[model samples]
Target: MQVKLIFSALTMATLLGACQKAPEPVVTTDAWSPLAQRYVSLVLALGEHDKSYVDAYYGPAEWAEQAKTAGQSAADIATAGSALQAEIRALSATDTMLRLRQHYLITQLTALISHAQTLATGKRASFEQQAQQLYDTLPPQRELASFDTILAELEALVPGEGDLTERVVAYRAGFVIPQDKQQQVFERAIAECQARTLSRIDLPQQERFTLEFVEDKPWSGYNWYQGAAYSLIQINIERPIDISRAVDLGCHEGYPGHHTYNALLEQKLKNELQWVEFSVYPLFSPQSLIAEGTANYGISMAFPGEQKMQFERDVLYPLAGLDAALAAEYAQFLKLMAQLSYAGNEIARLYLNGEIDAATAQSLRQRYLLQSEAEAKQGIRFVDTYGAYVINYNWGKDLVKNYIEQGGSEDERWQRFISLLSTPKLPSSIAWE
Candidate 1:
């Protein structure tokens, strides 16, 4: 009986051992790893040359320190970028995600090299050429006359107009949030946006931001993404604080906009997957297209159709001490204005290409964008500073909207949108169809 028991125990042990799988081999070498490290270092080095080159960096401290002291010229940086591109292209990735990483590196390196060469040579391509090279997509050209129909529609909405621009401005002036109540209104708007976004997306518990109202800035709002899932958002009070902008800025700069986008990339790609290339964001690369596009589209995503108007009417209007009855009219006006968004891009194209002077550009902005003189000048200042970057907002929004809405339920749409945020997708890579 003892011998039989011993044999059974031996048989059981053998069967258990056979069922256990072998220990998986540790992946010690990834061909893309070194190239990714080099890319991060190169991006840091480029930041040394152009103050605006590096938008955000949260990589190794030593790498940044090394870049500051490298003393490489633009030509040298371009050469290095080209070499990196060659190395990246020489390697092929079979895995789906790995292939995406490889393509991302290749396209980004191409933009980096092109920008470096431009800096070194002191010569620039045409506005269209530069847009294509820098942003990886060209904004559709629209004739200025194409906006006349929208302007006429706005004219009927705000009748008895001396000029359509003046009438529209006079109408919207009633919707400005009082200076004293600006902070309160903005806080409420941001909180609502946060709640909506949090319900749909899972973000790091520690991720957060601080808000400040700033003056003398060209742009209306800006998000400065700090590493570690934090951001500093500044709203330019230099212009009138429109009640609509509370939700616009709330969603655009905070919830599902720049702040959320940066946090996800840091959390998912940089921290989780250890993709070092995401550590530094270059301002001029194709990534901005995705960033700005999604940020603008986020306003609509967070509040679809009449949802935004309802929120502003019921919640924000009372908070700002404005008449809520006119909310529907303002909503219609804004929708019409959105149709004319492409006009800004056309005006910028004309101005940058020297087809029109600054004065002409400002005039077109007033006539088309229906801006006050101060606002028109501010718009021109933005165009002067950002150049082809004007296209990123409207064009990028259209691209992202189409991609997210392509055959999905609302839940699936949110999932697709979040997927775009977490992945390394370029403008050219997004499926328009």
Candidate 2:
């Protein structure tokens, strides 16, 4: 009887141990993960809904393809998007890291659905409303008349009989790089930009890019981020290529800008952390605020005030065969004119919401912004196509510059700047105000 009791006790302990062992944690998407499949659904559904929705996708193409094969109708997609958004909203995870990632996915998916609904309904949200919902920030738009002070300042710098616009145009016309020499000058400019960025930010050894000068693009320059630390940089040549644009374009498109931002995120987030959200870049999202702001701010970080002027006069002016004597004057005028940058946002608001007609928008561009007729028309065209995206340039630059410069020393500022470029950050992440 004692022997029987011993055996029974051992069996009971074994049973207790079996009950204590964890029922293997449900992790990894392949093990029937609703979240993973839902994410795949949004990507594919958005792709069908709008051609511009998926900016870059290096994920399993089969997933998107499978969703496309399902052939969900527009109504079906909208419904599914709404349902998934609700699910993500209700979802919770015990792990802190998982919770944050889930939140990011939820926030992005919600925006995707919001955009999809707006697209389907053809109901235009106000510029502020749309920018807030889609990009996660509202621009601090100023009155166009407020820019009179800045324009007056620029007028003094020009000192000409005709309108300030014409004088500024004729003066700037001297700085245009000859068509044949555009490629050579841009190449050197980007090279210097890369060197300067590397001095501060340590990029992946494999990071590299190809530069092309293309025409007829809406924006001045674009960086098409091909995954794995590669980017295709295109410069819009339709606008007269100016020598002053060399450093700005170089820093914006190459080093410490779009290319760097993309590469760092790809390396740190996608590669190391295996976060799938970073794998796809939606063009209209808040990420653009970070991308454009950091990129615009990068120009100054790479080449600060007197240094930029010296670089232009020393390297770019000679390369473009422009008058080096006018570099200083052009620099001052450019600084004064940058204040008028916010004017474009107001024009965009008016044009998009039907407060002003297209012609008036273009006309105002020439008069207030001091753009040439051709340039002004192009500027208005961008506003019509991109809507409140115009705010990304100046607004983004201000936010990033303030954030970076607020840190104590120049080195500390760069550290903050690089940290921004490298991390999985949203506009809200950096908001001080």
**Candidate whose lDDT is highest:** 1
The segments of candidate 2 whose C-alpha lies over 4 angstroms from its true place after superposition are 1-37, 73-75, 91-103
Q: For candidate 1, give the lDDT.
A: 0.84
lDDT of 2 at 264: 90
lDDT of 1 by residue, 68-166 (tens): 999989899899999989999999788767777887888888888888888889876567976888899988899999999998888888866488888
* Residue 340 alpha-carbon offset, candidate 2, angstroms: 0.5
Worst 10 residues of 2 by lDDT: 1-10
Q: Tell how far residue 186 is off in model 2, in angstroms.
A: 0.4
Q: Give the TM-score of candidate 1.
A: 0.92
lDDT tens string, model 2, 292-341? 99999999999976898898898888888888998898898888888788
